[model samples]
Target: MFIYQKLRDSILKRQLAPGNQLVESVISDKLNVGRTPIRGAIRKLAEEGLVNVIPNRGAFVIQPTKEEIVQAYEIRMELEQLAARLAVPYMDETDYEHMQRLCDEEGETIQSSDFRAYLQVNKDFHMTYIRKCANMFLIEFAERMIDQTNIYLMLYEMVFFHTSPQTAPGAAEHRELIQIFRDRNEELAGMKVRSHIANAMKSLQIDNIQFSNLGDIF
Candidate 1:
């Protein structure tokens, strides 16, 4: 489990990079484990859409298409908006403070050019609020969608406009979003979340020159 998490984290952080091949024997040797465990881990990642297993080509990181990226963000926009609406009445001071801390941490990561760390912290911050809705079904649904979208983001990040290396603006957006939540302004929160997703999609469309063919992957 630890090896799986470490490998997944490395992929998400881009430390492994897109299109990188994952050779089970090599990984087993490097991690000082048997091929059985490494193979199991790779299979798990493949199921999660993190790794692609070609019939004869071996395992590699999945590269997302432009359409897939757009679709993923669109789903995220809807789900997150719904989550914010559901969570507004349930949010307390503790949630607000924790969100603020997550924003600060994300800011630090972004400033340090640690995009992977920022992505993880950003997801954590969002999940923290979404979990407060206390609706298991909705929470699970939103989490899955976010997971898919994050994978898309990792795969096609360059397709979007250059993400700012600076953490201040991203942190500011997080802070503002939190303030909206604190005010119990569900409508504004939904709008902000939608806009944030839309901006991200727009950036990707303008920057990345490649378009993913959904049919090819499916």
Candidate 2:
């Protein structure tokens, strides 16, 4: 999984921007590994929807459209709202304590500006509620939508990084959501879940304009 990890980390760190060519030979030389592992890594990335492999052309990082990104968040808003509402009734005292610990960890990671740690804890924070949802189908479906949005954000987050301190506020929002859950205010918690998505979408967007740099969807 070395090649896979390298490619994923490169994309996450923005060393390889969206739509950057992932040539097998180039990767093999760059990573000083064999072509077999490089191809395997590319295949894995393609399977994960992080890269698109054209039949005749080589693999390139997947760059979803801004419209696609926004639409994904819209769907995520509904899914997360449902999750929050359902998760509140099932969660126990242990769950709340565990969530509180994660929120604390998230705050520390954000303060350190460890983007990777922040992203990891962010997923953990949502999945904590998502896993408690009554509906298995809803959980799986929500995860897929979240993954799609995350791929875009991971690669195209310079606009977000340059503007506000996005990570810290998001950690604070998780704490807010957790508190709402603790209060057993299902309806309000659901509203807050949707608001979280809305705020994330707005924060992700460029203030004045954004370039729709997406090329052909290979």
TM-score of each: 0.73, 0.83
Off by over 4 Å in 1: 1-41, 158-168, 205-218
Q: Which ten residues in a row have the lowest lDDT in candidate 1?
A: 209-218
The most accurate candidate by lDDT is 2
- Model 2 alpha-carbon drift over 4 Å, by segment: 28-34, 158-167, 205-218
Output the lDDT of residue 148, model 1.
Answer: 81
**Candidate 1: residue 177 Cα off by (Å):** 0.9
Candidate of highest TM-score? 2
- Considering summed lDDT, which 10 consecutive residues are worst modelled in model 2? 209-218
- Which digits, one per residue and each the tens of the lDDT, describe model 1 over residues 1-218? 87678778777645665666777766665667887777788899999899999988898877666677777788889988888888899999999999988977876776566766767898898899899877898899889887787676665565222444353445667888999998999889888878877865664432434433211221
The whole-model lDDT of each prediction reads: 0.75, 0.76
Look at candidate 2 and tell me the lDDT of residue 180. Answer: 90
